[model samples]
Target: MKFAHEFKETLERECFPDHWLAAAIPYSQLKKCLKKVQRELESLGLDKETLQQLLAEQTVSPNGEPIPLVRYNLDHASSRSLRPCLSIFVHLRHGQVIDAALSPASRAFLQRLSGAHSRPSAIDSSACTTPLATPSPDVSSDDNDEDTEGELERIEVPLVFDGEFFNILQTDVDSLDALQQQEEKSMEAEIKSLGAEVSAVVGPPKRLAKSDLNRWREIFDLYVNAQVFFSSHELDHGSRSSVKAVQQLVWFQKQVQTRGLLQSFKVPSSAVAYSRFLQLNATLLQNLKFQEINKTAITKILKKFDKRTSLGASVTFRSAIRSRNFLAGSVAKKLCAQLSQEVVSTVPRAEDYDCPICFSIAWYPVRLRCSHLFCVRCVIKMQRENKKHCPLCRDEGVMNADLNNIDKSLEKFMKQYFRKETEEKQRANEIERGMEIFGDQYKHSSCVLM
Candidate 1:
C-alpha cells in the first residue's frame, strides 16, 4: 500500500478534534513539494547518481591526507529556517580537475557549478557542527587555505525545493510543538484538579462509616499493578506503545469492574472522580496515537525525499528539525510521573512504608540515624545479634538507634493508612518472639490459652 494513502486514511480515521487534525503535517503537500525538489536537482544535472558521487568524492593532499571535495549541510540558520549548503572543493585555475577520483560527469558538474553563476564561499568551521552521525567534515583543516595548486574554491548550490521541503517540515514541527505544549498544559491542569478531587473522595477517615478511602486505595493499588502506560519490569522498562497502553488500560478498567471497586463507592463524589480519571487516561492515549501516526508520516516523507533526490536528507533533516514535546519525549512518561507525584501519592500505599529488611509494614517503625526505617522487632533482633550497620545502606547508624529511634509520626501513619497490615505484622512479631523464647511450640498470648 502507498504510504501517502495510508497516512491520509489514518488521519481521517483517527477522528482527532478539528484543531488537532488541522495542525497535523501536510504529508500530501510535502510529497508534492518533494517532487519539485527532485526536479530542481535533476534540472541542475544533479540526479541521484551525480549527487551521490559528488558527495562521496575525495582527494588526497600533498601530505597524504584525504580532503573531502564536497560537503552538504542542512545549515540551521535559525530555529525557524533550515537551508542546505553544498560546498565543493574546486581549483581556481581553468580546467584542472580537483579530484581524479570523480567521474567525468561529476567533474563537469562540479566545474559548471564552480564557474560563474554560483558565488564562491568559505566553509565555516562551526557551520557543519551538529549531532549528525554522518556529517560533512570540516575541510578547512590545512594550515594554509591553498593546496599545491591555485587554491580551492568553495561553491554553494542554490536549491529552491530542498529548502522549501525542510521549511515546511520544520514549520509543521514547530506548530505541532506549540500544540503539544498547549495540550500538555491543559492535561496537566486536569490531572492536578483530578488529584485534588480524588484526594477529597479518599481523604482520611471521617464521620462517614464508609468514606470510600479504602475503596480508592484498592482501586489505586490495582491501577498501579496494571502499569498501563509504562512498565518497570526488567523485560520491558520503557514506555509502552499506544497499542500496549490500550490493552493495559482496558485491563485496568476491567479489573475495577470485575472486583466491583467502582460499584462499592460509598462517597457520591468518588464515582465522579473515577470517571474523570478514566477520561484523562483516555485523552492521553488519544494524544499518543495522534503523535505516533504523525511521527510515522514525517518519517515516511523524509525517507521518500531521500530516495527520490538521493540527497541523503533523512539524516540531515532529522538533525535540522528541532521540536520539544511533539517529536522528542512521550506524553505518557511526563504525565505518568506527574500522576505518581500528585494523584497516586494522595492515597497512601503500604509499599511506601514497608520495612526494607522484612518487606512488610513497619509497625512501631524504628527510624535509624541513617533515616532508614525498620520494624521494631527486626531492629531489636539486629541489636541482640550485635549487628551495628544499617541493613540497606550499610551505615553505622543501626546501633546508634535506641528507644529514641522509634518514629512516633511514622508509626501513626502506618496505623492510619495500613491499619490491617500493621496489625497483622505486630501479631507476627509477637508470635516470632514468643517462639524464640519458649521453643517452636509456643504461641503468642493473643492466640494462647490464658
Candidate 2:
C-alpha cells in the first residue's frame, strides 16, 4: 500500500536518513502490485478508502525512528479464506530487505466477511466469477515461509554483521593480546638489568616495604580487571555481530542489566568506580590496542605516596606524603592504557563524555572552579547572557575570573579516544552553523540557478 502524505511527512519530520529511505522498495510500486488483487480486496470488504485508512494506521510505528514495515507474499494463500490479508517487508540496515507475513485478524467483521464458506455453493454468481483465496484460521501468518524453513529459522530482521566482520575483529583482538605479552616480557628483562646495575653500585638492594608492594598490587588489580572486562564484554553475546555502534551499546546495556561482571570484584575504590572505569577504558579499547603502561607516570605517583619507613629515607622527606589512589583519574588513565587493548566495540554513550549544554565534544572543555564541566564556546555564550553562576550547581561568582586554562586532560582524552564521535559532533555543529548563515539555501547547496 502507498504511504500516506501524512506518513511521509512524519518520517521526514523525524529526520529519517535519506540513504535508508532511498534503498527501500517504493510505496507506489507496492501499491501497483496490490492492485492485481483489487477486486478480491473489495470483495473482502476492503474498499480503496478503507484500505488507505488501514495502511495509514499501520504505516508509521514509534518503536524505532521512522518505524519498520513488512511486505511479503503468502505462499499458502490459495487454501485459506480471504478477509484482511496483508504482506510485510522488514527493513534491515545497509539496504537489506526481507519479506515477512502479516498475522491473521479475528475481528467480528472479518468473521462475517469470510462466513460465505458456511453456505452451500449457491451464493452470488459474482462471488463465483471472481474467487479469492481463504486465510487459514489455525496457522499464524506473521512468520515468513523461507525463514521458517531455513537454518536461521524464525530470525528477526536487521540481521547481525556477517562472519567476515567477526573474523576481522577477532584477529585484531588476538594481535593486541600478543603485543601486550611481548611488552610484558620486555619490561621484565629491563627490570632485571636495572637491578643488576644497582646491586653492583650500591652493595646490595634493600628489601621493599610491605606497604609499597601492597599499593602497587592494588593498582595492578584494578588494571587487570579493567582489561578482562573490556576484552570479554563483547564476547558475552555468543557469535552474533552488531552492524552499528548504537546496536552494540543497546545489546551490551541489556546484558549489563542481567549479568554484571564487576559487582562482586573488590576494588581499591567504591563499586561505582568500577562502572566508570569500565566505561572509560572500554571507550579507549574500541580504537586503540594495549601498549606499554606509562611506568614513569605510575612510578612518579607511587614514589610521592610511598612512606619513608626505611631509616635513611626519612631525612630527605620533609613535606607531607601524598598517597596515590589507583582509582583516581590520573592514575587510572596510565594503568588502563597499559592493560586494555583496543578491539571492535561501540562508540561510547555520548552522555558519558558530552557537555550537557552544547551536547558536543569539541571547542575546548572547561572545568569550572566548582568542578562542573562545559565546552568553552558554551561558557562564552553563558557569559554573554550574564549567566554568572554554574548552571548545574548554581554556585555564584563565576564571572569574577577569566575562564582560561582549558581542561587539557579531558580535551586530549576526547581527541585520543573518541575520534569517530569527534567527527560526528563537528559535522553536526557545522550543519547548525550553515543553517544560521545560509538560511533556507543551506540545504540546496548544489542548486546552480540560486
Candidate 3:
C-alpha cells in the first residue's frame, strides 16, 4: 500500500477520541459549538475578555457535522504540498474557560497574530464559530462488532476546499525539488574542493614504467593469495587436528622472498614480527606434536595475531615478505609446513598403539613402572586402586615415585587402559544383576502356579 494511505489507516485504527477530531465539522456548526464551549469555559472561572479571546482563537466543529473547509492550505507562501495539510484542529473547554482551537500550523499563526489588535477577521471567524448542540451519532451494533473484528470501511468524500488542492500540491513539489537540487550542487562542489586538497598533499599519482607496474601487481597478487590461503587453512584446522596449519603457512614465506615480493613493497623489518610468528607456530606445533592440544591455544594464537595486526604489523602482505626478520619467521613457517605434511602422510596409517583402558588410539603412550605400556587411563586406575606394583610387571612400590610427575607418554597410555577395564567391569556387573532379577521372577511365577 502507498505510505500515505497506510499512515492514515493507522491513525484511524488507533481510534482517537471525539475530542481529537471535533474540529472537523462545518463552520456554522463549529460556531454554535463554540457558544456552548464558551459557557463551559466561563463556568471554569475564565473572565469575560479571556473567554472571548479564547473563543475567537479556538476552532471546533459541531457533533456529526463535516467541516466546511475540507482541505486547508495553511500558508500561501509554504510549498503547496506542505500548505495543504490534512490535520484537524481542536478547541478544548474547561468549565467556563474556552481554549483557542487551531491546528499546529494555525496555532503558530495565531501566536503571531495575537501581537496585533486588528487581526484578519477571516482568521478570527475561523477560530470562533456558531455552537451546535446536536447529539453525537450512535454506532450500530453490526458496525461495532465489525470494529471489534479489526475491520473498518473507508468513507471517502471529495474534501471541500476554498481553493484548488492540486495547485497547492504542485507548488510544494516544485519548492521541494528546488531545495534538493541546490543541496546536491552544494555537495558536489564541496567534494570537488576536498579532492583538490587531498591531491595537493598526496601529489599526483606517479607514472610507473609498464614493466615495473606489472611486476608490482604480480607481487601484490602473490601476497593476497597467501593471505587467503592462510585464512582458509586456519579455519579448517580449528582445534580438530594434531598438526598446526600455521606452521605449514610459514613455507609460503620462501616463495615471497624468492620472488622479491617483499623488496617491492618497502615494508620495515622488525624482530618482533618474526618472534611472534615463531612463537605462535611453535605453540601450535608443540600442542600438535605432544597431542596435548586444546581450542584455547589456537584461539590465543589468533588473538595474538589480531592484536599485532591492530598494532600496525603487516603479517600477511608484501611488506611482511621483504623484511630481514622474515628469515627468522621462516623457522615457524617451515615447522607448520612440515607438521601439515606429517598429518597428511599419517592419515592413511593406523595407530600402532591403542589405549587398553579407553580402547582408543593412544597418542602419547606412557609406560608405568610395571613396564606395561597401557594407555594413560590404565596407569591412573592402577594408582587409584593403590596398587604400587605394575599391573603387568607386578613391581611393588612403583606408585611411590610421584605419579603426577610421570612422563606424559606413559600417563596417556595408563589413563586409556584403566578406563577400558573400568567400563568392562561395570558392564559385567550390570549383566549379572539382570540375570539375578530374571531368575527371581521365574521362581515367583512357578510358585504362583503351584
Candidate 4:
C-alpha cells in the first residue's frame, strides 16, 4: 500500500487527539515536494542518472583515501531550516575530466560549467546559480589558456525544493518536540500525585477498616513481575517496543482482573487511584503509539526522499534536525523512570531487602563489611559453621561481623514496611535457635524460660 494512505489510515484509526494530529508530519505534502525536487534537478539537465554518476565521482587524495567530489551538507545555517548545500569539487585543472565514474554527458556538463568565465547564462544559472557562477563557455580546453591554470574549485548546486522539504519537516518535528515536553510535564505531575495517594493507603501498618496495604503490595508485586511497558529482568533491558508494551500491559491488567484486586480494595480511593494508574499507563501507551507511528513516518519519508533524490538523506536528516526529545529520546524511558521513583517506590517491595542466604525478609538485617545483607540468624549459623567469607563477594567479613554489623537503620525499615513478615520471621528464628541449643528436644515456648 502507498505509505501516504497507510499513514493517514493509522492516524485516523488510532483516534489521537486533534491537536496531535495537527502536529504530525505532513507525509503527503513532503512526498509532493520531493516530486518537485526531482523536477527541479531535471530542469538543470541533472537527471537522476546524471546526478548519480556525478555524485559518485571522487578524487583520490595523496593519502590514497577517496574524497567525495560532491559533498552534500544538510546542517543548521544559524538555526534556520537545514540548508542542504550540494558542494561539488569542479576540476578546473586544464578542464580535464576528474574521475572515470563520470559519463560522457556528465563530464562535458561539469567541464563546460567550470570553464565558463562569462556572465551567467540561463542554463549555467539554473545549474549553478551563485552570483559568482559564470555561464558554461563554448571554448574547449584547447582553445582557451584562461581555463587551464586552477585546480578543483568547489561550487554549490542551487536546488530549492529539497531545502523547502527539509524546512517543512524540521519545523513539524520542532512542534512535536514541544508538544511532547508539555504532555510529559502533565504526566509527571500526575505520577507525583498518584504516588502520594497510593502511599497513603499502603504505607502504614495499623490495620483499619479501609486498609488495603496487602492488596496494594500484591498488586505492585504483580505489576513489577509483569514488567509492563518496560522490562526489568536481568537478561532483558528496560526498553520495550510499544507493541511489546501493549502485550505486557494486557497481561498485567488481566492478572489484576483475575485476582479481583479492584473489588477487594478496602480503601475506596485505592480503586480510584488504581484506575487512574491504569489510565496513566494507557495514556502513556497511546502517546508511545503516536510517537512510534510518527517516527516510522519520518523514517519512511526520509527513505523515500533518498530513493527519489539519491541524496542519502535518511542518516543525514536525523543529525541535521535540531531535535533533542521527540526523535532522539524515548517517552517510555523518561516517564517510566519517574513512575518507578514516585509511584512504585512508595510501597517498598520486600524482595528488594530479602536475605541472600534464606531468600526471606532480612529481619535484624546484618550488614556485612562488604555491605551485603542477611538475616541475623543466617549470619549466626554461617559463623557457627566457621564460614568466614561473604557468600556473594567472597569478602572475609563474616567472622569479623559483630554487633556493629547489625544494620539498625535497615532493621527499622524492614520493620516499618514488612511488619507482619518480620514478626513471623522473628518467631521462626527463635524456634530455630532454641532447637539448635537444646538438641531438637526443646519445646518451643513464646513465654520467657524462667
Candidate 5:
C-alpha cells in the first residue's frame, strides 16, 4: 500500500517535532493513532463500524467507494527477514480535526496537516495529473491470469519535505560524512604505528617475527569490528572500559572461527557446554538493546573452554567449527529498544494480556504484591478455595490483598493494544451469560418418549 498524496502533503505541512519521527513512522504507530480516533468517535454514541457499513450500502459508486485500509504484515517474532515496508493510507474530510497526541511524531504531523491544509491535495491540479489511488484491481476482479503475472506490484512513495526539515537533514548528513572520514584516517595511522611497534620487539622468536604478525593483524581487525559494532568511539572512556572483557571474548571467537584456528586453539565442542553457549547468545541478543550483557557469565564459559582446551582434543575427528550492553542513557536505550521488540501482528500476544490460570483476557486485572497480574474473578476463586498464596508467585498472604485494587494502567494498555482480543472475549462472555441464565438448551436430548 502507498500513502495518499494528500497524506504526504499533510505530513510535510505539519512539521512534526524530531522525536515524533522516530522508528521512521512504523505502521503500528499509524494504526494506534487511528484506533484512538475510532474510540473517540465511539464515545459520541456513533458506531464507526456501523456508520461505515451504512456509508458503503448507501453510496452510489460500487467499486470506487472509500474503504477503511487496515492490513498488517505478520511475521514470526524471531524472524530476521521482517522489514518496515508496510504503508498506510488515510482520507481526511474537510473540517475534520485530528488530535496529535497518539505519538509525538504522529500527533504533530496530523495536527500540522489539519491546520495548514484544508484541501485533499495541496499541489496544483495541472502539476499533478495522476488521479487519487483507486482500490487495487485484483481485489474485486475475477481474472485468474493475474495470479501468473511475472512482476510483483510496487508502490512508489514520493519524498515530501519543506525547507527547514530538509536543511536539518542535510546538515546531519554532512557532519556524519566528515566524522567518518576523520575516523578512517585515525584508524590507518594507528594500524601503521602498531606495525612499527611489532618490528621493534627485540629477541622475538621466528614464529613471532613472521606468522605472528599476520595473526596480530587479524586479531586487531576483529577488535576494530567489535568497536564499530558497539560504537565505542562515541561512548565515554568509562563505558568503553566496562566492555573490555566482552570485547576480548568477541575478538578471540572471531579469530578462531574465521582462520580455522579452532583446532590449533583446542576449543571444545562438548554438547552441554555448546548448549549453554547457544542459550547465552540468544538471551544476549534479545535483551542487547536494554541490558548490559552478563559479562561474568560469558567469562565463565570462556574459562571452561580454556580449561577443556588444555586437556587436548579427542581421538574422534570433528571437522565443523561454528561461530556466534545493558543500558546506559535509558532514553536513547529505549529508542533503540524498538528495533528488538517488534509487534508480530495486529493481534497482541495473548500471554501479555491473558490471565495465566484462566487463559482468558483478564477482566478487572489486579497486580499482586509480587507484581503478577490476574483477573479479579481468578483472585476471588483462589480466596474461596482457602488459598493463602498467589497462584503465580506463591507469595504468602496474597489472598488477603484487596481484590478491588486494580492496575488501571495495565487495563488501559490491554484495552488499547488488544482491541480485537478484548472484543472476542466480550462476545464469548455474553454467550456464556445467556447460557447460564436460560440453561444450556443442547445439554439434553430433544426427543419426547411418547
Candidate 6:
C-alpha cells in the first residue's frame, strides 16, 4: 500500500488518468487509501524490512495484518482436505516487536498465485495475534471503505499501451524540419551537378553561316508566296484570277534566276535541273495567251517538258521550219494524242468528280465565282492565301468561306487522288530508269532483225 501511494502520486502528477496519458500502473490502490495503510503500518512498528519480508512470505495483508494460510493437496489420500504446515516463525518475544513469520502453506499459496480469482484476500485477521492486541478502528473501517474506491481507480489505467504514441504526435513538426534541412542540402548538391552537366553538354550556340542564312530566307519567302497563291485560289472568285497570280509566280521565279538570288547558295544539281524545267514551263505559258491554252494543253506542255528533261533530251527545235512543220503535222497529231491520254488518265472521272486542286468529291463541284471548284484543297489553298479576292478572278469580289463546312465526299476524293498520283510518279521514274539502261540495245536488235 505504501508503494501504491507513490505509484498513484506518480500517475496523477503525470496526468495518468487522462485518456491521452500513455503510462499506467498494473495493480489496484488509490493514493489516499495507500497513505492511510502506510501510516497504520508505521504506527504498529512494522518497519520496511519487516513489511517486505512479510509480503515476500505472503503473510502480510493490505491493512498490515499477519495470518495463518492454507493450501490444497492433491497427493494426499483425501484430495479435498486442506494441508497444514508451519514454514514461518512468529517470534513472540516479551516486550519485543512481534516479528511475524510466514508458514510453508502461506508461502506455497503465494507462490501458486496465477489468475485474478486465485489471488489471496487482502484482509486476514485470524493469524497469531496477542490477546492484548486490538484491531485499530482507523485501519478496519478505512480498509473496507477504500477498497471500493481502489477498484474504481484501477479502471482508470489503460489495458494496452501504444509504444509509438508520443513519437507519432511529434513527427509532423520535428520530423518535417529535419527532413527539410536534409532536402535542402540534397537539392544544393543536385543544382551544382546540373550546372556542370549543362556546361559540358552545350558549348555556346553556334553562329549561323551567311550562305545558309540566305538560303533559309529564300526558302521562307518561297513558302510564304506559295501559301498566299494557294489561299487566294480557294476564294469565291479564285479560279479565274489564279492565272494572273500564276503569272506573277512565273515572273518571280525569273527575277530570282536573272538577279542571281540562287547563286548565293550551293544549289544541288537535281534542284537546278528541276528549277530549269519549271522556268521552261513558265516561258511557254507566257508565250501562249491564257485564254488560248486549255488546262489539258497546259498540263501536256508541262509533262512533255518534264519527260524530255528526265530522259536527257533537248526541248527546243533547232530550226523554224522544223518547229512550224512539227506543230502543223503528224508530230502535232502525236503530241495531241499523248496529251489527251495523259489528261484523261490524270483527271478523275465525271462520276468520281473530285477536284484536282482539293482531293474531295462530295461537294456539287460548285465553280467558285472565280470558276474554281469548292473542294477541300481549294478551301485550304484559299485559306493559305488570306487574300480578299480570288486568285483566279480578282475582278469579281470574294466571298468568305469556312473549310470545316466543306463536303466529306470531297475530302475522301482528295485523299485517294494524292495517293494514286504519288504511286504513278514512283512507277514512272522506275520505268524511265529501266528504259535508259536497255532502250538502245533493244532498238539495235530490232534494226538487225529487220
Question: Which candidate achieves the best TM-score against the true structure?
Answer: 1
TM-scores of all candidate predictions against the true structure? 0.89, 0.23, 0.15, 0.84, 0.24, 0.16
Candidate 3's TM-score: 0.15
Query: Which lDDT value does model 5 have at 434?
Result: 61
128, model 3: CA deviation in Å?
82
Candidate 4, 1-450: lDDT as tens digits: 988899999999989999999999999999899999988877665677766776777754322356666666786767757878775655444446454555666567666665663232222222333422222356464554464432445456667998899999999999999989989999999999999998888866664445777888888888888787777677877688888989989998899999998888878889889999999999999999999999999999999887777777888887778887898888988998899889888878888888998998898899998999999999998999999999999999999998988999888878777888899999998888888888789787677877
**Which candidate leads in lDDT?**
4
Candidate 5, residues 329-434, lDDT tens digits: the string is: 2222332222123211112344557889889888668788888888766776688788988777689765666845688887777665555566676566556556
Q: By the lDDT metric, which is better: model 2 or model 4?
A: 4
Instruction: Judge candidate 6 against the unseen true structure and give its global Cα lDDT, from 0 to 1.
Output: 0.34
Estimate the TM-score for candidate 5.
Answer: 0.24
Worst 10 residues of 5 by lDDT: 316-325
> Model 1: clashing residue pairs?
none
Q: What 10-residue stretch in candidate 4 is worst by lDDT?
A: 118-127
Over the stretch 73-118, how does candidate 1's per-residue lDDT look in tens digits? 7877885799787655555444444565556665677677655443
Please list all clashing residue pairs in model 5, or write none if there are none.
20-105, 100-107, 291-325, 291-326, 292-325, 292-326
Residues 50-148 of candidate 2: C-alpha lDDT, one tens digit per residue? 434333433322122232232211112122211121322222211222222222331223433333322212212122222222222343444423323
Instruction: Look at candidate 2 and give me any clashing residue pairs.
Output: 70-88, 70-89, 71-88, 71-89, 72-88, 80-134, 80-135, 81-134, 81-135, 82-134
Whole-model Cα lDDT of every candidate shown, in order: 0.78, 0.37, 0.35, 0.79, 0.38, 0.34
Error of 3 at 352 (Å): 48
Q: How are the candidates ranked when ordered by lDDT, highest leading?
A: 4, 1, 5, 2, 3, 6
**TM-score of structure candidate 1:** 0.89
